[model samples]
Target: MSYKEFLVQLSEASGVSGYEGEVSDVIKKAFKEIGHEVTSDNLGNLICFKKGKNPKGRKIMLAAHMDEVGLMVKDIDANGFIKFTTIGGVDQRTLLCQEVIVHGKEKVYGIIGVKPPHLTTPEERSKPLEIDNLLIDTGYDFEEINKLVEIGDVVTIKRQVYNLQNNHIAGKALDDRVGVAILYYSLQELNKLQHDVDVYFVATVQEEVGTRGATTSAFKIQPDIGIAIDVGFGKTPELNQFDTIEMGKGPAFTVGPNIHPGVFNHLKTTAKDHYIPYQVEVAANHSGTDAWPMQVSCSGVATGVISIPLRYMHTSVETVNLSDVEKSGKVLAHFIASLNDENMEELLCY
Candidate 1:
């Protein structure tokens, strides 16, 4: 499937942090289509294994999260209005009047209800709306709504991927869905290479809440090298240069405390040798991705991070450049092909 088509389907699937099953199914099918051995761990992480030419070679893991920030029904009012708590890191500012899909006994469409500007007092208008005060109106009366809606139902922002100028696209869940798509494409590219390392493509869950899936999966895999593919802040007018990487610049490989210097250098060299357009990301301490947990897994796994630049993170309109997404897949495939028995031994050495 094409990247655009894959992303569209992925973005539309509602897979909130603790509820990633829906998205996992789609990913599992994709992996199976490519003939990879797919399995799910007790923690819901989907692992796809592609055996290398050398059966005893180094194990390399590529991780991308399958969860997106959303909401969960907390209460159902007598009048049929649904009250919810933010699932991950939802921005209250983006909640007003937005369309959402509530996963209850049945699929229900709802809209966040905001006080009409004219109805709000001047004091209220001066302050940001609190999440506690937000309500989802499904247009169903109490009796009808109660039968279909219940507390604890997952809620996701409703959005479809839309293409923009300059090879960019915007939609919800691109934060990591795009990363997952990159993995799919990378696997495809790897099929054409003579890599000597076993590759584990992990579609991890609950990364929005924490790097929960990566933590457990990395421990189980005990990979020689772990690479976390995730979304990073993209440059926008509202963001400063130091805070955001540019979109369309190609995939970014991180350098920092959380990243193994040797692994980072390896990826950097691979990108340079292949002439893949790329960027550098500096994370002072925690990389705030699966890399954080993967780095400390087991005794210690040499971990690196490659991120796709995304705009408007954790919102329904997250955006990324498709060109950069494609580039990331190629870079990963090339990096894996470059890992030989000799270099794998030096992956973590200073």
Candidate 2:
């Protein structure tokens, strides 16, 4: 499937943190259609295996999370309003006036309601916003809403993927779903290449809550090399050059203690040899991605990270450049194509 179509199907589906069943089905179907041997782990991670010509050769793992940040219903007021709490890191300021799909006994549309400005006191206007003060108005009374909605139902942002000027697109859940799209495209590219290493492409779950899916998958795979595909902060007016990468420039890779030097250098060399545009990201500590867990998995796996530049992360209007995503996939495919026993020996030789 085309990247645009794949993104729409993924973004429209709601798979918040722990509740990733709906989106995992989409990923499993795509992998199966691509002729991969796909299976889900106990933690709900989607793992696809593609055997290489040399089954005994090095094992390479590629990970991209499938879960996104959202809210869960917490309480219901007598007036039929709903109170919700975040499932991940959520900025309360962005809650007001946002449309949400409440997943309950049935799908219900609701909006984050705010008090009218006409009635706001001067003190209220000066105070900071809080999620506790917000409520979701679904246009149903207590008795009516009680039958359809219940506590613990997931509430996801209701938005459609749309194109933006300058070859960009905006929508919800682009954070890691964009990574998932890259993995799909990379698999398509890898199918045409001859590589010596066995490849396992994993769509991890609950990454937003904790890197739980990656942890379990990495332990099970025990790969010789692991690469985490995720989204990094994109350039915005408020962000500094050191903190964000420009959208459409190509993929940015992490370089730090968390990243293996040999793997990092291999990726840089592959990009240069293939004439693929890429930027280097410096992380002093952990990269805050699946790379961290993959690095420490088992006896220790050589790990690297490739990230697409994304704007308005964790918001409903997260934006990314499609071309950049494609570039990342192609670069990954080339990197995989170059892996072999000889390179593996040198890469692990300290």
lDDT of 2: 0.91
Off by over 4 Å in 2: none
In candidate 2, which residue pairs get closer than 3 Å at backbone N, Cα or C atoms, i.e. clash? none
Give each model a TM-score. Answer: 0.98, 0.98
Error of 1 at 216 (Å): 0.8
Per-model lDDT: 0.91, 0.91
- What overall lDDT, based on C-alpha atoms, would model 1 receive against the true structure? 0.91
Q: Which ten residues in a row have the lowest lDDT in candidate 1?
A: 341-350
TM-score of 1: 0.98
Per-residue error for 184 in candidate 1, Å, reads: 0.3
Best by lDDT: 2
lDDT of 2 by residue, 141-256 (tens): 99999999999999999999999998899999998999999999999999999998999999999999889999999999999999999999999999998999989999998999
